[model samples]
Target: MATGKYISYLRVSTSRQGASGLGLEAQRTNIDNYLNGGQWTLLKEYVEIESGKKDDRPKLQEALQLCKATGATLLIAKLDRLSRDAHFLIGLQKSGANFVAVDMPTANELTIGIMALVAQEERRAISRRTIDALAAAKARGVKLGNPDNLTIAGAERGRIAGVKSIKSKADVFAKDCIERIIPLRAEGLSLHAIARVLSKEGILTARGKAVWTACAVKNVIERIEGL
Candidate 1:
C-alpha cells in the first residue's frame, strides 16, 4: 500500500490528441487505477502536449520543481509518456525528483538504467536508418534541405538549453539536500538513523519520497564527500 503526496504528469504527442483527450484519458485512467487503493494525496496534475523526442517540457519542469519543493512523488501513467529518450530518462533520475510509472511500479534505478541503455541503442539505430534514407534520397536527386529542417534544428537547440537550465536548478536542490545530510552526519547519526531523522523532519529524498533508506542517505553523503 502506497502512501504519500503525488504530482501527476500526463502528456500527449500532438495537439489533436490533447484537444480530443485521446491519449490523455487513458493515461489519467491508468494513474487513477494505480492510486485507487493507496492512501495518497494528489497534490497536482500537469497535462502537456509535446513530442517525446524533445526534453524541453515546460510542464514537466514545473512538476519536478513542485516535487522538489513539496516532497511530492512524480506520478506518470507510463514510462513512454515521461520520455522515450534514454539520455533524458537518465538525466531525470538525477534531477532530485522522485517519479514512478504506473506501468512499472516496481522499477528501480537498475531497471531504469538498463532501459536507458536499450533506449539509447534504439535511438542510435534510428539515427543511422534516417541518415541512410536521407543519403539514398539525395542520391536520387531529391531535395533535402528545407525551412522545416531549419526550424527543427532551432527547436533542438532550444531543447538543449531548456534541459541545461532545469539541470542547473536540480543541482542546486541536490546540493541543499547534501548540505543538510552532512550536518546530520556530523551529529553522530548513523545513515539509517539519519534517514529517519530527515523523514521525521519532513525532508524528502531526491525523488521526493517521504521515506528514506540507509543506502539513499549514504548516497547523499557520498555525493557531497566526493566534492
Candidate 2:
C-alpha cells in the first residue's frame, strides 16, 4: 500500500457514542484496516462530538487547516460521518480537500450527483413528516419551537478579552518607545539620523537591535493611543 500524508477525521453524533467511543473507535479501526501495511503517514487525527445537523465542527476545521498547510488528503471512514445532506458533500468536494470515504469507495462524480438528487428528496420527505407531526400536535393543542442563544457568548467574551490583552501589550511597547526614543529623534533627526544617534550613544531597543524604522516609530505612537 502506497500513501502520502493524510489527516483522519472522526465524529460521533451523540454523547452516548462519544462516551462509549463506539463511533470513533469504529472509524479508527476502518482507517487502520485501510492503511493495512501501507506507506501512509497519519499526520493528525481530529475528533469531534457534535450532531451531523451542522458543519461548523471545531476539530474538523483544525483538521482541514492541517491538511491545507501540510498538503495532505482527508480520510473519513464513512460519508455519513460528515453529513447526510448532499449539499454538504458538494461543498466538501469544492473545498479543495482530497477526500477518501471508506464506506463510499464507489462515490465518483456520477454517484455523487445521484446522491445529491436523493438527498433533495429526503429533505422533502422530512419537511412533509414535520408538517404531519405539527398537524397532529395542533389537534392535541401542543405548542413547539424553542428559542435560545445560538452563538457562544463566552467565545465572544474570550475574543474581546484577547483584543484587550493585545491592545494593552501594544500600548506598553509604544509608551516605552515614545517616552525614551521619540524625543531624541524629534531633535532634527531622520530615521537613519536617529539610528546613528542611538548607535553612537550605545543605546539599543528591547530586542538589542540597533536599526530603526519610521514604521517602528509610528507603531509606538499608535500603541500609546491604545493605552
Candidate 3:
C-alpha cells in the first residue's frame, strides 16, 4: 500500500492566541489550495499551542513522528514557525524528512543548517547583553529585582528569584547576584518573596518538582526578557 503524501504542522506560542493569526489559518488555507491545485495529497494535519522557545509541543512532535513513520514530507507555512531550538531542528533534519517552509521555496538542508546556527548565535548574544545590563545596574546601586522582596518601609533585599519556562524546551537556571535598584524599590516586594510564596504554595518547577532557588528563578526571568 502506498503511504500518505503531505503532513502539515501548525503552532501558536501562547494560549491566548486566536485561530486566525500567526499564519495558522493561512497555512491551512494555502495547503488546502495546494492539494486541490492538483499535485499533492493531504495525509495529516497537526495543530498546537505552545511557545516556540519551548520543546513541549505535543502536536508538533506527533506530526514529526508521523513523517518519520510514513516517509512523508512535512510542510509548514514558515520556517521560524518551528521552535527556536537549533538542537531540535537539527534532530529533525537528521530524521530524513523533506521539510519545506512555505516562505522559502528554494530552502534546502544546507540553508536550514545555516539558519539554525544563526538563531543559536542570536540567542547567545542576547544572553550576553542581559548579563552586562544587569551587572551595570548593580554597579549603579539600582535595585534590579522583583518587587516581591521589598518591605513596606525598608529597602528591597538584594537576592531575587525568577523562573524562565518555555512550553516544552530547555529551562535554564541562573543567579543574578548583581541587580540594579529600580524606582519605588521599597513599595514592592522582590522576586525572592514571590518565589517563596510560589514554592510554599507547591508550584512545581519546570522539571515537575518542588524546588525554588535564586538561580532557577533568574533563569526564568531571563528567558522571557524581550517578550
Candidate 4:
C-alpha cells in the first residue's frame, strides 16, 4: 500500500480521449485503488494529451519538478503511460524524484537503475563477444564472402554459442550470489548493511570485486528475482 504523498501523471494519446475522459478516468481509478488503503495523499494530478511517441512532454516535466521539490512520488497508472524509452527512465532516476507505476509498484529508482545496467551490460557484452568471434573466424581463414561455405555457417553457429555461454555464466554467478543474499534481506537487513556484511564476510561481487555497494546488492537481488 502507498503511504506517502504522490503526484499523479495521466496521459492520453489524443485530445479526444482527453476531452472525453476515456483513458484518463481509467488511469485515475487505478491510482485511486492503489492509494485506497494507505495513509497517502494525492497532492496534484497532471494530464498530458499527446502521442506516446512524443518525448517533449511539458506536463511530465512539471510533475517531475513538483515531485523533486516536495519529495513526493511521481505516481502513474502504468509504466507505458510514461515514456518507454530506457534513457528517459534512467534520467527520471537522476531527477531525484521517486516514482511508482501502479502496474509495478514494487519497482523503484534503485531497481530500475539496476535493470538498466544489466540490460546495457548484456547488450555490450554480447555485441563484443560476437564481434570478437567474427574477427577470430576471419583470422582462422573463414572467408566472409563465401556464404556457400560450410565453414562460414559453422563459425556463425560458434558465435551464437559463445554469446549464450557468456550469458549463462553471468546468470549462474548472479543466481549464486543472490541466493546467499536472500536470507539477509528476509531478516530485514538494510541494503547497505547487506553489502557491508557481504564484504566483511569475504563475498565478492558479480564482477569479482571484494567489496559491494548498495546498488550492486540491489542489482543482484533483482537479477535473481527477475529470473
Candidate 5:
C-alpha cells in the first residue's frame, strides 16, 4: 500500500483539453484507483499543457519544487503524461523528487514479447536501410554489376563511410539519453523497463522513432560498454 504524501500532476497536449478537463478526469480516476486503499495524503494536483516541449512548464517545476520541499512523491497517471523532453528528465533527477507512474506499476512477461517484436522491427529497418542505400547508390550512377574488384572495394568503402555517418549522428543524438540510461541500467532496471522509461520521456531512438525498444536500449548499453 502507498504510504507518504503525494502531489499528483496531470498534463494534456493542447489547451483545449486542459480547459475542458477532458483528459484530466481520466488521470484523476487513475490516481484515485492507485490510492484507493492506501493510507496516503494527496497533497496537491497541478496541471500542465506540454511541458511546453520547449521545457517551459512552470507547473511541472512548481509541482517538483513542492515535492522537493515537502518530501512528497510526484504522482502521475502515466509516464508520458509528463514531458517527453530529456532535459526535464535530467532536471527531475537533479531536483531529488520521487515519482510514481500509476499505469506502470511493474514489469511483466509481456515486455519480453515486446522486446522480440522490437527486434523484428529492427531487422526490417536494417533491410530497408540497405535497400534505400542501394537505390541511392544507383541514383548516383554507381555500377551495381561492376566485375572489377576496384568497384567492389569502392563500394565497401562507401558502406563503411555510411556506417560511420549514421553512428556519428546516433552518438550525438543519444548523448543526453545515455546520461539518463546508464544510471537506470546500473541501478538494475531491465532493458525493456529502460526502454519504456525513455519512450515515456519522449526520447526517441536515433532514427527518431517514437517508442524505444529493448534492442535500442541494448545498443546504447553496448555504446556505454565501448566507452
Candidate 6:
C-alpha cells in the first residue's frame, strides 16, 4: 500500500561498521525486500556513520528535509537504525512526513511507544545485571576496585576522575537531546505535547524518570539555551 517517492536513510553506529559493512548490508537487504513490489520511486539514499545516542545527524536531517519538501516517504531498514531515541522518533512522527521501517511495516505510534518502553527497560535491566554480577564477584572473595593497588588518596583521585568522565558523557547526551527538542518546538509543538511525545518514546530525564512534564521540558530547553 506504499505509493510515493521515497528517500532512504541508513545509519551505522561506528565508522568501522560503516567501512566493514557490519550492519549496513542487512539494512540494505531489508529495504530492498520491502520495496520489491511497491509502487515507490527511490529518490536518494543517505548513509550516516554515527552513534545512535547522538542526535546531531547531518545525513538524517537532509533525508527528512528532502522527504518534507518532495512529499516523499522516508524509508529505513530498521527502526533502531533510524534512532533508538524516542524523542527523535516522536519529532519525526509530528514532522508531517511519512516514514516506514522495513522491519516493521505495520508499526504505528502506539507500537513505537511500546517498543521504546521495552528498550528502555532492557537497558536498565542490563545495568542492574552488570552491577549484581560485580557484587557477586566481590562476595566470592574477589578483590574489587583499584586493580593497580593504589593508596587511599589514589583511590579518591580515581573516584573523582570517574565522576568527571561520567559528567562529560552526560553533558554530551543532554546537548544531543536539546538539539532534537529545539527543532520540535520550532515546528509548533507545545511543551506539553513535546513532553508527551518524549515520554511516549521512553526518553528519560536527568533523574532517569521515563515520564516528562511541560515544566521539565521547558527547564531543559532553558538550561541548554543558556549554555
Clashing residue pairs in all predictions, respectively, total 2, 0, 22, 0, 1, 0
lDDT of 3 at 99: 72
Q: Could you tell which candidate, 2 or 6, scores higher by TM-score? A: 2
Q: Candidate 4 local accuracy as lDDT?
A: 0.75
TM-score, model 2 to reference:
0.54
* Per-model CA lDDT versus the true structure: 0.75, 0.66, 0.58, 0.75, 0.71, 0.73
| Clash count in backbone of candidate 4 | 0
Query: Of the candidates numbered 3 and 4, which has the greater lDDT value?
Result: 4
Clashing pairs in 1: 97-207, 98-207
Best-to-worst ranking by lDDT: 1, 4, 6, 5, 2, 3
Superposition error at 39 for model 2 (Å): 1.6
Model 6: which residue pairs collide?
none
Off by over 4 Å in 4: 81-83, 114-227
Write candidate 6's Cα lDDT for 20-105 as tens digits.
34576688788888888858799987777768666677777889899999989888787864545654565566666788888878
TM-score of each: 0.58, 0.54, 0.58, 0.47, 0.45, 0.50
Q: Which of the two, 3 or 6, has more lDDT?
A: 6
Query: On a 0 to 100 scale, what is the lDDT of residue 10 in model 2?
Result: 75
Output the lDDT of residue 7, model 3: 90
Error of 6 at 185 (Å): 52
Tell me the deviation in Å of residue 162 in model 4.
55
lDDT of 2: 0.66
Q: Per-residue lDDT for 1-227 in model 1, tens only?
A: 66899999887775545533467678889988888886899998887666778767777778989999999999877786454567557766767688888988887767777878888888899999999999999999999876554687878987899999866554555576675677887899898998897776545455545467899877766666665
